[model samples]
Target: MTKKAYSKLLATATTTAIVASAFAPAASADSKDFSDVSTRYADAVSFLADKGAEGFPDGTFGTHLSIKRVDAAVLIAKVLELDTENAPASGFKDVPARAVGAVNALKEAEIAYGKNSSTFDPDSHVTRGEIALWIERAFQLEGSVEVPFEDVNNRYKDAISMMVANDITQGLTETEFGVSALAKRGDFAIFLHKAYQAMVEQSDFLLTVMHTNDTHGNIQDIAKRATAIEHVRSENPEALLLDAGDVFSGTLYFNEFLGQADLEFMNYLGYDAMTFGNHEFDLGASADGHKALADFIKGAEFPFVSANVDFTKDSTFDGLQNFEVSEDPADGEIYNGIVKEVDGEKVGIFGLTTEETPFISSTGEVQFQDYIERATEMVDKFENQGINKIIALTHLGYDDSLQYDNDLELAKQVDGIDVIVGGHSHTTLDEPVLNEDGEEPTVLVQTGEYGKALGTLDVTFDENGVLTGYAGELIKVSDLEADPVVADMLKPYTEQIEAIKTQSIGKEAAVVLDGVRENVRTKETNLGNLITDGMLAKAKTINPDTVIALQNGGGIRESIDKGDITMGEILTVMPFGNSLGIMELTGAEIIEALEHSVSAAPTASGAFLQVSGLNFTYDSSKPAGERVQTVKVQDGSDLVDIDENASYFVATNTFTAKGGDNYDVFKKAYEDGRLSEPGYVDFEMFAEYLKGLEKIEPTVENRIVDLNAAE
Candidate 1:
């Protein structure tokens, strides 16, 4: 017998029987009235009868009769919940008119096949081993477990293994599966019921989420993003379009329109929701406070979800903030979590912003709560609402800022989150990261920065809302044709940005400024030197006592080409609009900060510092936090060794002065009234310094020497 054909036949029969039984009136009387039905088969008969399954041709259920292949096909079809009403011809002359639909539906699903091209042998009784294969394939069951049945052979081993793993059956006996025995109506009912229960309980659910993160106001590809969104929606119409934040800063576009430009495209693309990224609060300390951020939130066509970010302190968000989870969330509002009903299933989505936001961005009074605590609370709140499918939309880095929080730690520590859409570290997860170490598995994914790619994730969940399988990948945005409507919508913004890009900053570079990722993040480069020198020079005009300047390598986004630098190039390099800050710190704190800076040396760290007015030597062989060997500060003309107890003034961006990039010492000093923000934007200051110099020729002068070098 062909096990494949048998399984499909059984599946079809099971389904048809269920549909018939479902509509069947309470068995002539109650199922208990059937004296011919055994206690074991009585419940099964009642279940079928209650659902409207007719008894065997004779009035009473023929419990002891061998169930025919035609009967099994109908039964399994009901079990699989397959549509049988419009099924085509079964191609078997012997098949009865009533069994034709079930058989054809089974064939269409590739769950069952005829005995031959033209013969279904519909009257043949299905065997125990045959039903096993049918149940396995019909339900798409998977797993490997030992089967002790002696009668089961290699051909049926995989099917039996899955059956055993799922506890679908225990065999005809402890050591026997009765593989060759013909299936009786009574026993088949019990097996079919179990299969039906499995179908109901472990049904596969498909969820597609199209996500992007750290777009950083790079709407140049918004049209392509729209195309990518539509492409995915064509395949998965119900796919959720989500952004993991950092849509606030970058490029000349953000400089001109703030976040309004990005918001327009996001609205047109129909984003489902967004979370708060650190850069979203970059303007918090501005004269107007968070008015821009408030406007951005107000202008959003979709709601925002961030459990840990408290906008309560800022009255600007008074009407927008909703501190509790919402079942019927409205657009243009904020919620701790929201219940989204997708195809009759409830999906819970919450958001988390990194707690380091205050230290990294000018968050003003918008407080950040502990991510783990808020996440746990959100999960509990969702579970209370009977929502088991939970998605944590977060702007926390994938593996960054470990001193505070990250997605990996969240997945391992949290219990219920099924998916994590992440950002901040700008990690490109070509494949979803699976973390099953927690009570339930969690899938983490992110798209890299600058709107270069769109991330797509297809996940499968069981009926119980447990993540079972996932496929995630980054779709290159440049490859897709731009959507005409979005392209038209983006033209005005692009035009304004293009005009800005062509406008020169009144300065020229004598040499190519090296600010490539590999070079700047690992070692000092000409651009790093130039940027830091500008920071020092700009700081001195405000505070002449400032002796050192530092800039994080990660902040230096791009290199300046050898020519007259335009506003676009300047903005591209220093896109965050970070302001200069002068901080008073003890020599020990500065030394400690330097140690933290080079800690990830050999492996480029975003926290790596590029400096001016100072020189430091670190031993890479030494462990992190202990790598610094010597530190020198320029005192008028001579470089003097740093005194651990002495105090010194340093110039850097406000982000670093407030302890961004795990610089806790700087945060302490900022909190202790030792840092002053001068309100000069980094790019503007660089432009000023460049214009003053007329032309630039900066080079690395051993400002930072690593003791351990392969050469």
Candidate 2:
């Protein structure tokens, strides 16, 4: 028989006279009646009755009937009308061979799966928790309901929350739940009936605030993200979208197009809010970074907020609201946080970024304050103004122990902050982390970085602005259906990226693999050697005396994977938009910088250099500057020892020229205005230079052998 015909046959047999008799016992007396069932559930029996689900022959509704695994599968298949054409093969030895097809069908529908080892215990009694999970899987329900269960920890945590969120099951007693216990037939019926009603009356008034962080100019997956958001929003009408920042920098897209296209795309998607990320200042804190921010803000219909950033001194972000307070029509007053009525309940959202932004952000002109201090002040201000339901949208990292305090710390320290919507550090919180404060649980959530996932928190608040409860999940974008509108928005960029993908660079006779793991930091790789050689070669055109070029290993983002390397791939490998800079430094200063690089060997920092036209020996056991005992320069015929007092021409990137890589010695060299011929060394230009050489091969030889290796 064809698959559809087979499914129809199974459904007919399962609901036929014999099967109907078996199920009739469940609706008979001696069946349990669920006392806690909501009033809406009265209509549930009628709905089912209209569909010909009658009470058993005993005149007793067997509402407390123990559901078997096979029966559970059948119910789910019947409810979803799932096609079983490509179902997973049932490998359960205990399941009756005749019942295997039903189990496979349920698995194909994604409504059921074995706990482990592919064993679907077909005869095992289904528990209340299992039923709850199956109901949730069959229908995607997003709302917060009261589950007054106590003892429902870990194993059934998600299931219980889902049951509550969908109004399927309440606790056994007033405040207790035996999640693992088998549910009575009447109670199960009531639960399923309530869930069925919820599915029918699923509110369109629900507003989902889906968010992501640390995009870092990765526009390639924009359509994928847009599709996922659209799928979520289509399920709920009042969906408000937001981004957690770090949307610019990191990739060639930002370097080539700046933030204009990214901002325009975010605007097109109707993003509700965006907080500032440290990398937003990659272009510098002056007019460059602020100008981008101004352009993005001007084009965006929504607000961009940061309560901790004191932009009073900055001219560019003068009019933007740092802290906005407004009255929520559904609830009461709200401050700093945005007030939106979702499912007829008002929610308040505020935002904060890491205080370390000043140090890590390329914007040297802007300053950041203590995050907790600023956040607490904002909370107090909002609370005093009678706004109680608060959500702090934080960009701080998730870890919040006393030693590594961050957003979770902010959640714990501050009072009246209900939830902390967070980003940065790219943490994927599967479930909301509950703060240990004891007074009220603070829900902390963060979606993993790169637009790979969306964080959702479905919450419910009492009329008094107190969080009665909530349910949350990190929806993986890969699992969602793509939004066509978002796909169209990103089509132009996708076309450009696709056009560049296959374009050939100069052919390599031999492989020049990125020996990043082994030599990029502690020493030099042939790849790094080639790059620095090119930088020095380009630098020498202006100053022939330049003997050495130093490139920080961190600037080289990707390795040259084996194959016919293309120009686009090379560009991706070195996407940072840094330029070459030549400077004159005393031999002592060069030695000082080398020592700094060697000292970092213990910590394994990327600031360690891959050098060309020079070699150095260091004793890491010695402290900092004293580590480098010897330095040499090749002078055509011989390797000459460096004289500390002799001035030498050096080449490095502009990031290092400004005393980056902990090279304070260069700061003085910069102060003396000895820096010359500072021009942009597009990494692509270096790649092109490599292409011209054809058959280029580079390897990792021990350029910086540890003298202390034996020890």
Q: Which ten residues in a row have the lowest lDDT in candidate 1?
A: 21-30
lDDT of 2 by residue, 1-711 (tens): 132443343333223221222233344222124343345444554334333344555554444567677655654554444554456775656656545665677776677887665678777788877787787777666675545677776766776787777656667776777778886655655765676567546522222467777776767667667766676677655766767777766455665567766876677676777777766765664456577766655666666657776665666666654445554311111124566555566556677767656544455556677777777877776777666667777777665222223676787778778777777555668876667573666767788666667777655445566654555677777776566777777778767766766666656537756746545776667778878878887777656788889888778776776667776767766766565667788888888888878886656667888887778777777777678767888677677998889988889986787677767887677655566523334464476467667467876555555566525
**Residue-level lDDT tens digits of model 1 in 591-699:** 9999999888889988899999999999899999889999999988889999999988899887787779989999888666576544456886788688888459888
Q: TM-scores of all models? A: 0.59, 0.53
CA lDDT, every prediction?
Answer: 0.81, 0.64
- Report RMSD (Å) for each prediction in the order shown: 15.0, 15.1
Candidate 2, 85: how far from true, in Å? 31
Off by over 4 Å in 1: 1-202, 504-528, 534-565, 568-613, 616-711
- Which is the leading candidate under TM-score? 1
Overlapping backbone residue pairs in candidate 2 total 18
